[model samples]
Target: MGNTYRRVLLKLSGEALMGDLSYGIDPAVVDAICAEIKDVVNTGVEVAVVVGGGNIFRGIKGAAAGMDRATADYIGMIATVMNAMTLQDSLERKGVQTRVLTAIEMQEVAEPYIRRRAIRHLEKGRVVIFGAGSGNPFFTTDTTAALRAAEISAEVVFKATKVDGIYDADPKVNPDARRFQTLTYSYALEKDLRVMDGTAIALCKDNNIPIMVFNLAVEGNIRRALMGEPIGTLVGGSCGIS
Candidate 1:
């Protein structure tokens, strides 16, 4: 099937890379995700990724425990680069061209992030994995995903999470919590659904970028989402019934 999006940005948390492990990346899980990504790229859809660092270290948690916020965040940023490199290795092993661009300069390891260069790589059908969380301490990877999506003119942002979609309440805790197939940015923010944090959601809202939240654990979901399958909650613009 043809993809509905020409270019897309995928947001993945570091915890997602952990799979069922307690911490750190699980090679098997990264391989599976990369395989899915390779499949989408073969279909001629440009893909960019923004991965988080919660599994290795969370800056916020460190700060809460008395570490300097900026220092902790910088360390967190480095952790993201580690994740990006791992993803790049996996994708390349699958015979897919991939680039690891870091917000912070890492000449020996990866190329520094240049907006036009990143776009050019995407245009050439190479997967670009953006690491280091915007080169700033205060930003989250979610915000980076939104910012990069806008900068790259991605057609949509796919937020691959553990949950299938956004729920009225914690689906794990509330068996009856409802899932909205579609949601307006205002509603998601007003209700604080934590879809991608306030900054990320607002960035998407201002740019009119749609976000599709789906379960990454479900095999073939990335391809399904690209096909415009209604398997997740879409957030952006207006939804008549949501």
Candidate 2:
């Protein structure tokens, strides 16, 4: 497979690390993901990952349970840092150079996020994992991925979801749901598609960053995406497919 994007931001949901389990990180699953990332890196593609904390904690859920929104979100951010460290360890075990960068200051665990420093890490063939979800209460990791992609001038954001691509409805719930090969940002917003949150999608739209939503459950899909295979739904380009 030929490499298409020079640099790409991969958005991995925290739940994806759960594998067959219902909660927390699964070691086998983490190893598999790191293997995929290693393959992508070996192909000469610069990779930056933004991981979510939904598996460990959901800020909205906590807020609904009477916790302060800001405090719940901070807990969620810390969860992401934990996930990032786990992923970094797995990647390093596979001989891939990795760095964990957190938006919130955690000097003992990770480097404080700096745009130029992150770019430098990528230049040196190090995989940079961005944790902590933009270091804010309201922003989701999806928005963080979009922001970092723009900052690093990534060619695209590969959002690894359980579903193979973006559909009109949830495929798991609606068997008849139709999947789109391509979509415009306006169409996605108008249809209220859950491809990504509104804030995240809007950020990509404003930055002209294309997003490819694909299934992480499918083995080797990450490498396929890095090679520019037509494996998932591509959003925001001149061509629009409804």
Tens digits of lDDT, candidate 2, 1-242: 57798999999999999998899999999999999999999988999999999999999899999999999999999999999999999999999999999999999999999999999999999999999989999889999999999999998999999989999887889999999999998899888898999999999999999999999999999999888999989998574885
Name the weakest run of 10 consecutive residues (lDDT summed) in model 1: 233-242
TM-scores, each model vs. reference: 0.99, 0.98
- lDDT per residue as tens, model 1, 1-242: 66788999999999999999999999999999999999999999999999999999999999999999999999999999999999999999999999999999999999999999999999999999999999999899999999999999998999999999999999999999999999999999999999999999999999999999999989999889987899989997976435
> Where in model 2 is the C-alpha error above 4 Å?
none
- Model 1 residue runs over 4 Å out of place are none
